[model samples]
Target: MGNKSSSQPPMKWPQMPWTDRLLLSLVTRLRDVTCHHNGTVNRRLFPFLDHCTAANPNPVEGVCTSDITIDSSCNLYVRVFMPSDPSIQGRPIPVIVYFHGGGFSFFSSSSPPYDALCRRISREICAVVVSVDYRLAPEHKYPAAYDDGINVLRFLDSDRLGSIETVTDLQLDFGNCFLAGDSAGGNIVHHVARRWAASTRDWKKVQLAGAILLQPFFGGEERTESDIRLDGAPIISMERADWAWKSFLPEGANRNHEAAHVFDSIKAGIEEAFPPALVVVGGFDPLHDWQLRYYEALKEKGKEVRLVEYPDAIHAFYLFPKHNDNTKLMEEMKGFVQANRSI
Candidate 1:
């Protein structure tokens, strides 16, 4: 196990303002009531609430859907959001491959929260957004998701896969690519980045501009004090996370294996060859120190890295539209992607 400090303070969810509290209460009630009879809460509830909270009505236009198969049997469904105006100034628009967060066991690209966020990013950043629907776990195991991710990128870069398409009917330059994801999705991005760097095939030459990790889980074999303190934290608890990880891995597989835990596989090739990355974490999140450690690792390798910590936020806080912090985070993300587009 990695270093564990019992002296660290217990983690807590950030306090919400009255308005936000009321809104959250309403959402909780709706979710509870729906799940009471339905047996499961629909993941779309949160995104639907987000859409309602936003003053703008679907600012994104001309969204398209497609599927790219990673293997002969398994197919990955992808949802793409293109800028309303596809007329680029003869330059290739940057592309963001977004992976949805669901502990790698739940959710899909069709989920409302992912769909809305992808659309918003595509419009706001003036870039192409590709929301990947990789295979889920327990049914599929560790490295399965990672393999699917790498294959998706390969498919996009290959003409044989026929996965590439113009955004908003305008020519797209595949040269600029960004990888972004939340939770388990973040884990996928990290592993994919490492694999891409180590791959020897010509297909591995695709240029990656940057990567964005939102509350990523990077710890392997050890739990930080924050994880212990937030053992029963709302939404995502340490117990829940452990279960998710176990289910996502093959039966009897070691959790500490490099293929299972991204941080364990740290090597010179990964540290030096990875593109600049931005890691966003909530101060109250159990994974706070985990993300910080990842940032430190990147910096030690002399790679351009940025870390943004929201002092008064929680895991998945960015998905809530009613929170002002969410908007601020989005703005920062937009700026980062725009500034790094040329890289």
Candidate 2:
């Protein structure tokens, strides 16, 4: 260790199992041929890859789930997870608005992994979870996903939840609502929170209390130390990251665009009203430097932001239950929510 005060731990790259490797490789190839080349998702193959989960109106693990449309025209919706735990039934609980990570070009709120993750969050934290099924890129492209992310909040703010007995009766604490996401979803969380902050409104409900960004996908044209060292990262290799940016960012735009490089070049995005944040970073993630830059940039602007560094963990480590870091992450998130509960 460099110093007793340093939070940094020993560096260790996670060993990828052959099964995970095979799945990742297959998914990447499918996105290239079906989504990119064909200008639309392969109707037959993409669903197989997504392995989408359906909402169960009845309780599962003491949590009830249902799907609600945010925008039917664009196929935008949210899978709502409400804890049916008897003790917490009639009381207000923190609400977490979640965005899933797939480089912004893949995955959905209903993706099996995300469904499980959101359910765990709802049941463990005893909070309502709304996983946004934002439109994918290379088809919808830049700003489309961002717009959809914000729209979810707008939908919630409209008090539509009050109309649905399942959601309305849950008594979600709108004042304690939080934004949380990983990878590209993390990127969406940041942008959506910023947009919410910049708005001037006194809506009946829906106040952004805090944000949790896990390995937020942000980059620039210039390479950093982590970028060079983890070029061949286990899952989120630099090549895959580059491809993601190409698909999400506007055509002809480089990684230096404001959306891709939030911490630098355009410091204006960090608004004073932006909610307190907890940003998680993995040592083995190539985006490590970028995530750190975001934390520092927030500090420089006098914003409330905390950084959690898992030196031995790899990118997207929070998704898997086996990773020790994932358990730690959930603990940190729970503490953050309890501490940041807006009085």
* Model 1 CA deviation exceeding 4 Å by range: 1-12, 17-72, 86-90, 160-163, 166-168, 267-271
lDDT of 2 by residue, 79-105 (tens): 998888788766778889999998887
TM-score of 1: 0.80
Cα-based lDDT at residue 97, candidate 1: 88
The 0-to-1 C-alpha lDDT of every candidate, in the order given, reads: 0.69, 0.81
Using all chains and alpha carbons, the TM-scores for the candidates as numbered come to 0.80, 0.89
Colliding residue pairs in candidate 2: none
Q: What's the lDDT for residue 135 in model 1?
A: 88
Regions more than 4 Å wrong, model 2: 1-12, 15-43
Q: What TM-score does candidate 2 get on C-alpha atoms?
A: 0.89
- Model 2, position 223: C-alpha lDDT score: 82
Score residue 148 of candidate 2 by CA lDDT. Answer: 96
Which has the greatest TM-score? 2
Stretch of 10 with least lDDT, candidate 1 = 50-59
